[model samples]
Target: MFNDRPFPVDAFPKIIRNAIYEVEQHTQAPQGLIAASVLGVISLACQNRIDVCRLNNLRSPVSLFLLTLAESGERKSTVDKLLMKPLYQLEENLFEKYTHDLTIWKNDEAIFNIEKKALMLKLKSDIQRNKDYFATNEKLKDLLQSPPKAPVRFKLIFNDATPAAIKDHLCGYWRSVGIMSDEAGAIFNGYTLNELPFINKMWDGATFSVERKSEPEKLIRNARLTLALMVQPDVFKGYLQRKGEAAKGIGFFARCLICQPDSTQGSRKISSPVVSSEHLPVFHQRLMEIVNDNITLDNKNDRLCLRFSLEAENRWIEFYNKVESDMGFFGSLSNCKDYASKVAENMARVASLLHYFNGNDGDIPLSAIEDAVKITTWYVNEYIHLFSKPNEFTLAITEGDELYWWIKNHCNRHVVPYITKNTILQYGPNKFRNRSKANELLNMLQSQNKILIGKRGKTTLIAIANLKPAI
Candidate 1:
């Protein structure tokens, strides 16, 4: 029961949809990759500035955790680079400002240290001589109070960072950040995944204390973080093979919106026209506007809370109940109950992102929630397709379906009326490339009347039953 539906690109706002379309035309990348990249950028920009209010009055950050699984030459990096241009430019500008500010602060800090040393000497001498030391003590107190303040270092994105480094940055510098990478082998294979509990807490937006033996304990409060990683299919499967049980036990994968799309490798043409420079700049401008607004606020942690309208709330509750029911013992989503449980909240988070990114100021409308549901439902099905274990009958159906598609595609491409069984056994899907397996699936399809098996001059030929000729 692998429901491999295409991603719902039309559910996105116009700005996002246009960008995805233009990028797909230019790069010929899978729409799933482009959509994931666009959503990652939206999460980075909106996570710090907006919060979604659930029906229970509880507020949650709109940050998202995305995992994209593709093959090696799928152009994942190219898609990411195109969408992340604004963030790169912002980081460069912020780094320059920080460097300038650091220089001035260093000189002021030197002068303050010298003055403090001299004042301490004078105060000690006056105390020993029993002279009036009250005025000197007061002067020293004033000097300590007026010591130079260090400027805050503004950084928005990190590629490969340890859990400790991430905690330090959020606690000591900016309260909002994103950990994004085109190749995330370091993150999945390193110490970051080892600390699942820490990452889970950050995703929950919970207040937690990080205690160090050599320094004071740092408290992380009202901090926001977005994690988006793109890795090859084999690497991700290896991670699951090693730590699948632990990850499920802690509900780690339950927090992620994972996508693994069919590759578009051979279909991309070198002569494809270059993308019009129009759509991406609009996307970049909108992203910069939101980021700049977040930067200029007096308190970075203060977020604008968005609530659902009455109609939207009713729709949300209905969706919640539907998901809950589907997690029953015999329901479609019963295998992945953890993911099903969290899908509603993820839907709300997505709706909030859509609402805010479109510059809507009022409560989240029904249309946004409806659109979010369509997108999130696709993710729900994708999760099941990737992670769920199918019974024997299900596996047979899946294999038969794959073989059917292969035969149909081969016929259409080569303009052949029938395919030899030997050709299928040689070039079909790997699962059915053997003699015994090929016969088993071919017989099954013939019984279903979806394909015909016949012989031409002592050679077995396979043809798609009633497949219309190409126009």
Candidate 2:
């Protein structure tokens, strides 16, 4: 199916457009591919900040899990390097600061423990004396109550990390961070990724507790994560084959804004001129402004928040109602209704991200909200086009389709309408080592009015229905 409503390119932020133009100048990739990369950069910069804002009485963390599908030579790595320079630079600076601070903290913590042990001994002695003990005990208790605050590392980016490691990073470093990978196969293909419980919880900004026998239970709160990954379709298909429907059942894929860009392969005519370096400096400067903002902690030591504008709120109400109705009514989105249902929330999140890109810490504007709506709609349509099949049926449908194509190609080459049982059993699509599986596919194709199956002299035969003459 064609994507009738393509991405709203004009609705993207000016900086995003500029960034895309810059990359396309050199990469010769499609605009959508470049735009998706730029969006990843924006998502990384503003995931934590705009998550503090609310729309339509619903406050959602602005964490976007974006997956851009392209072939190996689509220049995904090139675009990622160009767009993600600021984040890498910021992470480097943060590492330097954290290293220095951690050293100081360890020193302070060791000294404080020594002082605390001495105070405990003195308090014990005073209690034993039982005379003038009350005053001394009170002083020691006061001192213990105000122990030094522990220092925290502030990190923003992680690559190829396990959920446990990510939790630890979010708990020890900044409350918000991103898992960014150019080759997403590392994250998706890793065995630990099958049961991604942490990602499911963190995306919702829900609090989680990790119990440890050797240490105190760790409570994680206000955790936000942005995911940006570029994956080859073959790798993603392998993931689907390995994980089956489990990934979708657990809402792993549902959380992702998947973009399958039309290939730019075979389109490169000649080397294009390099993009001007001037655009990136300003882009980096703006990104740095947000990164440098002081993240204020709440009473619970979590980040503070902003709210939505009146116009934005009203628009959300309308959009939410429409999408809800479409989900209930539209057959096209039936299998992906769970993901499609989130379009409104995701739009508001994108709007908040765009709003914060301009360094605004206040209400999200109607303009940004509208633009987000357009973009989210495009994504939802794309999602339906790509993943509209029920999880359980996907494997069967995909296999059946592949079988049809393989048989068609083989028949055309051999100039035969029907394939012999022995040949098909050994060399057919899916190579029916299990004859029952081949029968199942034949039954499925029969139901679809695409093929006919018969048995002759203990040999099962397959033939295309309404077979066309070889051209």
Candidate 3:
């Protein structure tokens, strides 16, 4: 089944595909088991090293928001730990190194504060006595010059965090970090989910103003936030039931690469877990290299530039035009046109991610751009399935229409002028559990002039009108 898909696991980079294959050997999950995991690694790998090269005179940040829908027992957390282990190790190493520096800095700050307080006192005394205060003020200025700065607990990834906390962390990390959560509910249902405006702006690499009472307004520039969220289908469904339209309306889900692959619960079998080999170590090592690769942030705190080849540029132009065509009148993606319009940008970002993962130099390869397009196509289909409404009919309404069609076909197949209530309860396409539903459906059909419901000898009957399905 995965082999037949447009973007199969095999289409991923060799290192990523190898890692996914190794993990699947232990978990026995779906073929796309590591789809979100790969994105998680990319989120951290591309955090500071690269951005999507300009394509068709347009460029977008390589940061991505990804969601993989599965069930509770899909080993999502195990996969997360495996992919993020290198990041955790880096965090530990940084903590140990920063601990000593922070202590020394704190001692220097204490001495500096003591000297500053003494100078302030002396200056006040001199001013009150009408004495020469300029000399004392000069001493104070010298004492306060070049205040000590404590080391920050730099982090590569965060799991559960509020938007306000995320803002502060971004500032600490120079406005570049990745958010990875095995459970999406932690973020979707958190207190800061209401910070949608800030979240949206950051995702688009727009400046966001962080207001504070004590400090001046901070304008965060070139904020790149990469996210990889995994959620059970039912939890995501619940989120949709409550905040689906609102989330989509604000372009939250529109910026995501969502995949609801078939579950691999009942089919999973016990197996020996594979030990870490050079194959997996190489990928992890590369990711750590990116983490340690000193990124030269510009005045805007933006990462290094990533350029594309001429052929890749042309391919993006063709892809952009195709997407633009569908964002107009009577187009299939008119409802979610905002998402459709960003297809080219998303492709560029994906290509850059692949380019970095492959350890490539110079312009991005055409093969990477093509693969990105395929992945984006799958994302478009998933988005339509989730958000797009056709002819004012929601998925529920369309499904109800389908049920009505099945009933009509069932009656015609038996050549029965009327479909009995007992027959519908027992053998109808839906196998309705109660007669009330059948009665209400019959009433609706009667109003549409498709059927007539009548009672005959204490048994309810549905009389077919026009002898054709309403759909």
What is the alpha-carbon lDDT of model 3 when measured against the actual structure? 0.71
**The candidate that achieves the highest TM-score relative to the unseen native structure:** 1
How would you encode candidate 2's per-residue C-alpha lDDT over 236-347 as one tens digit per residue? 8778777847877788777878777654543455664555666766777888776666344332444445566888888877988887777776555666777866677788
Global lDDT scores for all candidate models: 0.84, 0.71, 0.71
lDDT of 1: 0.84
The parts of candidate 3 lying over 4 Å away from their true place are: 1-7, 55-57, 96-100, 123-138, 270-276, 294-302, 328-332, 389-471
Model 1: CA > 4 A from native: 1-3, 270-274, 390-471
Looking at model 3, the pairs that clash are none
Q: For each candidate, what TM-score against the reference?
A: 0.85, 0.74, 0.77
The TM-score measured for candidate 2 stands at 0.74
Error of 3 at 259 (Å): 1.0
* Ranked candidates (lDDT, high to low): 1, 3, 2
